[model samples]
Target: MTVSRALSKPELVSEETRNRIEQAVRELGYVPNLAASALVTRRSGVVGALITTITNPILATTIEILQQGLSKAGLHMLIGETRFSPEEETKMLRAFLGRQLDGLILAYGYHTPETLALLQAARIPVVELWDLPEGDEPRTPVGQVVGFSNWAAGAAAGQHLVDCGYQRPAFFGYEDARENLRWQGFRQAVVEGLGIEPLRYNTSAIPHIDDGVAVIERYVRGELEFDGAFFTNDMPAIGALFTCQRNGIDVPGELGICGFGDLPIARVASPALTSVRVPAELVANTTVELLTQQIKAEGVGAMLNDVGSELIARESTARRSS
Candidate 1:
């Protein structure tokens, strides 16, 4: 009884008794059966985090910070990569909810109806990261949001391009909803700034740096002559910049380039890519704070925080005169 109590709730045991128990545990290489303990306590020291994919460099820091924060709060994180498939996310969510979790964290607010229903049914703390509901919607369907505005970020990118005196700005991105929202924002800024309709490249391909090279090649061949372009991600933007350098296309002089997710490589690139910096650290820290509060029964209901985006204007989008 004393050892179990000490192991489960160390504060309840005397200092001397706890020290003795710890010494014995170390000698025996004792590891408590969390499953059995959970059966009795109804509390699992585990939280499940669902992301689109582990390979995305954009999410790497957020995931690292989230894991470290959760660990410090006496919780363990179980990560599941849904690979951008709603069906896969639904499957992972079902399994996590079925078994045990003190809380749940998702990479985005978008989900299938079944997934939405599952979130509604679950009693654990639910957190949505990376995106917020579209204009005027006060809260996400899940009613907990901690992210920046994709639309606004896109608009900022477009506006920056125009501000740099790029007459024609084209966009390159995937067909994802978030990408579409960004394009919409970008289009709004371009139309408002230059009174010209921006081009949205028609392609179903993922945002690879090679796509950027191909676009630049078209410009070199006179097939397309966009003075500026916005890539929904930094990879393609960097690719385009590199292509420009190799083809003798003057950056921010002949062309202006901007990207999303101001990755580490964005700054170190020869010309330094211009990008919208998503608040990964802020999002992760805020997520940890809210989820921990929810787990502790702190009555934190439906928190909606918009940690606005930061536009880092580097050499890629520097003024034409500069």
Candidate 2:
């Protein structure tokens, strides 16, 4: 009807004529080619996802959920891995823009200004997840932001320890901004919030179970007195948990341990771990939903969706008597 202009010229052609033309086209089975349609419409039906490191299991899990969510919405996900470098991330963003994707998602919260400008030029939806900086900034409705506050999770761990009557506590994690944020929050809560300065330790890189064992050994052998411990992520926490078990040190009874990103094994450990529960799958689903909305120009406003996380109580860290 639009092609024939019959609606405009109803007097020129009868309704019967318009209906006949529609019926004939439907019978012939003419399908519009998306490539040809894109030439005029300028839509690729593709979303770009940039992860900090593809090798990291945590990030891999997040991306897996994101891909499934995008696929269900009939959108394709284009993935790029930047090894925690700003320059490399910019290059990846440019490459994605070259493909003319509808939206972009970055796993690392940090992005260079140049890349931000380039994304702005592309005028597509952009999302940053997993440790966004805390500040007063405008929400990117044109894009979207979805994830939890690392600072809050850290504070929660600190408060849990305080509530459990652990006076002396220690913080252990990598020396990155994400880890730092958690440490900062933990510091504030444990020191200023609860009026006790917790001993802080930083690792050069991602702390594995071996690293956890080493830290605990150093503390125990060096006479570092601590009643509780908080780890950056579950890997190191679990590491320390087993290390304590093997050393014949009682958990909660002797030293309380709390971890972040309550992984699956947190509950399965000999003494279940008490840690912050980050909904990895929820982050993935929301990222895809925001991207799909951006692609469709659905006018969904700037998404600063803060999915609330919970603290799972397990045996790894239990309250102690004063």
Candidate 3:
């Protein structure tokens, strides 16, 4: 009766009835057998994961960890790709919800009002990863969020560059707003702490190894002079590093490079890349933990948890001026 009241006519059910039902559930060892329960509740017994693109090498590891964590929590994952379009994202949301997912994990920041309203109407747990809008109001069936400070990671990268005493550092970053925060933080720190302005180049295109190769080559041919560069990500950083070596520029001697995400390649490059280590597995586990709490209606409030990041100095960025 409690399950019927809470799941069917929650509005008609009194608080006392809900509590009594919950208490009875505990005493009777009644577990939510989602397989059987889904028949009654019309849920799909799955969590919908909407991501930008699964093809990106960096995000692939994140997806792997997320899948493992979600699976361990007894939830199957249904995936949708947005192709970086808001309209497509909304469409994907409608499709995912049509299947009646028990929860949603969005790689993009937040959902549109139409999608949000639908989730509220359905009363499902939603988790937003990576980025989020500030000062969002609490909508019913509110989402629980967990992520790191991209800006803080960027600032730390800046501080590292400054501390290394590179007279001139160039910043190569992608056009994505999420990546821009890191570049902005990096630039601000370099300007304020060292009283020096770093040269900045925004990649009009998405991040790619060839993009890194081309930029470094262009700089070399044009006689641009810089002691170091902070590539927004590891792949491009590796590209730049090899480009420098090919051009007879001594890495960490004539140039220093740093990248973000600290992918395995970062540690395996000829000179291991010095990078910021983002705890992907921890982020994945924490996200699932928060979702689990939400599913149990455990009084989760507006969460701004930072899994945090660290700079690991490797051979690539280790050069000190004599």
Candidate 4:
């Protein structure tokens, strides 16, 4: 009992006793069994985080920050990738829950009914990262959201293109709920604000640079026409830029290109790509803070933390002085 108390709650024990216990532990090389400790305390010191994909640099950076923050709080993070599939997400969630996780962080807000039921039954701290649902009454599987509006970010990019005097613009991205929201925002702004119906091309799924290249190739073949294009994410935008270069299209002069998620590569591209900077660190830190508060039984009810986004204009979309 004394050793367990000293190991679990060191502050409750006397310094001399704690030192003796620590010395004995060091001499014996005794590693405490976390599983046994958790069984007695009913608290697993483990948190589960699910993201759409681990391959994305922006999401990877966010998860890295989250892991660091949780580590400082004496919590371990187990990550799973869902690949934007609700069934896969639910399966991962069930597996994590089976392991007795103390909290959960999900990159996607949408959820299957089974997943929602499981989460509600678990009654653990849940945080949904990334964008929320569209419209004023946004519905989330969990009440906690730690991200900015994808629509607003998309709108800002669209507005910038319009302000730059691009009459004919298009939107390009993959078919995902998050990207769809961005596309809706971009299309709404371009059509409503400028009264110009922008062309849209939503690829099948998990669009790569080759997909972007193919779309631009189609445009070059006279199948599509646009003076500007707002890519939902940096990957496709960078790809489109490469396509334009190979086809001898003068960017910003002949075709203005804008991307979201102002990733590092965007800044170093041939013509520095214009992009929307999502607050990745802020979202990760805020998620940890909120989850910590919940774990401590603090009153943090249905929180929505919008860290906001920024539009970074670069050579790809920089307007020349007449």
**Which one is best on lDDT?**
4
Q: Each model's C-alpha lDDT?
A: 0.87, 0.77, 0.76, 0.87
Model 3: per-residue Cα lDDT over 13-102, one tens digit each: 788888787788789987666656677766555888888877666567778887887777667788898865656788888888877787
Question: Clash pairs of candidate 3?
Answer: none
The stretch of ten residues in a row with the least summed lDDT in candidate 2 is 135-144
- lDDT of each residue in 32-74, candidate 2, tens digit only: 4656655666877778888877755667799888888887776
Which lDDT tens digits does candidate 1 get at residues 200-310? 985433457887898899889998868999888788888889999999999878899998889999989988989999888999999999999989888795578889998
Better model by lDDT: candidate 2 vs candidate 3 = 2
At residue 160, give the lDDT of candidate 3.
Answer: 87
Better of 2 and 3 by TM-score: 2
In model 4, which regions exceed 4 Å deviation? Answer: 9-31, 320-322
RMSD of candidate 4 to the truth, in angstroms, is 2.3
lDDT of 4 by residue, 1-322 (tens): 9998998778899999999999999999999988887898888899999998898889999989999999988789999999889999999998999888989999998889999999999999999998766655566647588888888988898888988888888988877677777887888889876797898887646646776788789989999889889887788888889999999999989999998889999999989999999989999999999998888778785578888899999999988444
All candidates in order of lDDT, best leading: 4, 1, 2, 3
Clashes of each: 0, 2, 0, 0
